[model samples]
Target chain A: MENKTEYKPFEVDQHLTAHGNYWAGKAGSRFFTSLRDKKKLLGSPCKACNKVFWPPRSVCTFCFGELKDMVEIGPLGTVETFTLVTYSEPIQPRTAPFIYAVIRLDGADTGMAHFLDEVEIGKVHIGMRVQPVFAKDRKGNILDIQYFKPL
Target chain B: MATKDKEWISIPMTVDVPYRFAAGGYMTKCLTELRDNGKIFAVECPKCKRVQLPPRVVCAECHVKNEKWVELPHEGTLMNFTIMYLPLTDPTTGKPHEPPFVYGSVRLDGATSVLDHMVEVEPDMDKVWVGMRCRLVLRPKEERIGDLSDIRYIEPLPGQKKPQTKSR
Candidate 1:
């Protein structure tokens, strides 16, 4: 409180930056390496539950089965759902007036979330086939595959 | 693709989160004045009459609302200090101040609470001590935007030498 009851509002711009080294862990390391080096998508399968998760997890979400092995998924995928982001947020990977969609890559049972571009917002629809667009500067992160474009 | 599995990959991430906050009544008045006019103001408790820097709405000890604003002098005493050997990032600017530097709490004249800031001086032990007189240096008016950063640093006043002491 600056006063007993009243005061004018003033804004101060600041940043809370945290620099850290993240261990992508065994499962994430395998997934990211292939994605970054080979320009490929990988998914881990849960045999017990008959599910394959894209952005492969170390273990199955449905069952407690260990998913140590990764199989190549697709550069091609179908849009499961989509939305348009018109407002700005600090955490947003891209600026406002962009599209984000849930896409299920070929050979993967689960949907992976990523940005969608190279298509109009009005043209986007569920089950629309799309392809991954790789970045020129490939850092070993999810953003290495910049966005998904319409096939 | 066949590759080395001996060394598992780890991703290095630096999360830069932008933060914003609204400076309320007393703080807005205080910071705006300091930002625009280069004046430092604090609030005094009505009941106990203790003046506080970074002026607050209530005096916690007195249990009364603060109404009076007091202007403090740029000069004060170096009450406490430490020489940091680590290059630590300043949260306000998201940049690291080079290692081997000095910073301290300075109690400005007419203020009850001490203000903490970087002390501009050599990091050598022989140069700094408690009770050392210091003066607040502020950024030029054109550069100030009404935050605590307006006060650039605290520099030790001239001609003050550490008192001689006997060693055990």
Candidate 2:
């Protein structure tokens, strides 16, 4: 194929940088705090249907009721889907080809999303069992569980 | 009357902005290395046989992993190019890319695909065209960051003959 240099139009000059802070809301705080205790947590039940929500939503999806309190969940689950990631410069750790996945944790009705590590990409599957690997020192944070690995 | 006073009122100001990055995978490492070495790299998919420029971790078409790495030749033929007269914000650095500038996709000599970059060209509105040859200008290592800026811009390769366009 021949190389063609045709003048096309584009907006070539605008600029910006990392310009804000992330503030966790109430449900987010509680969700992470419970993870520090080594307890898998999900948002409150619907008084009507007894369903659990994760990422601890403010309201129930099934019954449409307000959610309150939190419930502890098990650590194991099956992999639903995943993709590989590569973190680079200015990206601390500089890790490339890192895998992240959506896991359907055991005992919890809904799945949680997090980084997947310590396994072969080909070995992983939709039904592969996996568990969260918490950091040695826990402070009740989502990062407390560094990532999930095949069990 | 008010113009004289307004001239003295001019002062420098800074503005803050928010941005999100979606970068991930081996492409990140490849770009980092390119900035570090003053070179560019690409990957070839064994399955579909399409050499992907700006190497990706997996083949989008083949659904297979790409593990081999090959260093690319710095020179290339300018594929599709453009000269933008309007200003736009730089996504990575959050600054404005200079106006009256050119950008294009260049097919590196060794790689199978073309990459987009700042193409060197005359600012005159009259004399730009297709099938131009360009060369890469790289930044020094110490000053380099693992970003596209590592290679300053693509300029006309030395001693290359200009193409004659057929008049329609």
Candidate 3:
């Protein structure tokens, strides 16, 4: 003998919570300021350890020391690694195929991740030279250079 | 990631994220103006002498407050792009924006910056290019808010093989 049971669809709200004031570092005014201008300024480079910092910071990630100045970066660079994104959740417009890659700029010691354009995924390599294309007017932001393209 | 089966059913739903977000003092006022005027805004740093498309309250370079508000040219290049197979749900509308949408970083022409948002286009991966020029399409006035989403998506620019800018 087997027992039969009814399934009920329950409505619920997922209350995801975190502790304390965790400010989104990316949403800060300084970020928007430079991003609007099209300037790609990374976190201050640690003069002692030589680590290229993004989101310009007060201290170095490597030596735990102060970062002195904003470092201008990436008019040209190389592709470090990449992947073709085939899937994402259906929330916005969906495009099945695109490539995302990590790029190491010419002067900086670190790699920045962004989209790779003007080339097929099959043709993308680990060491392709790319450049930043700024918008007509500089807003002083990172998105000013839309993406690194094959140069 | 998992594949669905005959026994599995897909349910569409909406999510809402509401919170008081912070902006720089000068930018806060400028963004408030753009939201009122149905325009998008960004800022430039005087110290580093770089521009930010989203606008800012403080200079990322000198770690000081940047008081200047600068309007950006709507035209720009599609620096980077991605096609999402997954639907990024609109917390406000409580629905997905629709499948096969393009999202990208548009470096606005005049400002030294870029804006990231959804794009309305065919999700053809090969068709997307880094240097592709794009123009901004602003949202209706009533829908305006001092937020990044105020200006809609960026469309391809006209008659330019490469983005219009001096080669750095």
Over B95-128, each residue of candidate 3 has an lDDT whose tens digit, in order, gives: 6777778999888776666778776566875556
The best-first sequence of candidates by DockQ reads 1, 2, 3
* DockQ per candidate, 2 decimals: 0.52, 0.05, 0.01
Kindly give the stretch of ten consecutive residues in candidate 1 chain A with the minimal lDDT sum. Answer: A1-10
Top-TM-score structure, candidate number: 1
Error of 1 at B166 (Å): 3.6
Q: Worst lDDT window (10 residues) for model 2 chain B?
A: B4-13
Q: Could you give the C-alpha RMSD of every candidate to the true structure, in order shown?
A: 4.7, 17.6, 28.0
Candidate 2 per-residue lDDT, tens place, B88-127, comes to 7776564788798887888888777887888777754344
- Deviating ranges (above 4 Å) for candidate 2: A1-151, B1-25, B125-128
- Model 2 - which docking category? incorrect
User: Can you write out model 3's per-residue Cα lDDT over A42-135, one digit (the tens) per residue?
Assistant: 5457779867765456667778886657666666888889988888755433365767778887667778787777888888999988876666
DockQ of 2: 0.05
Write the residue-wise lDDT of candidate 1 on B1-168 in tens digits: 545655567777678877788888788889888987899989999899999998999999988899888889999999999999999887887689898889899999878999998999999889999999999999999999897778899999999899887998
lDDT string for model 2 (A1-151, tens) is 0113222222223346444434445566566666665466555546677666656676778777777667766577788888777655444332677787888776566777788899978887888888888887876556677889988
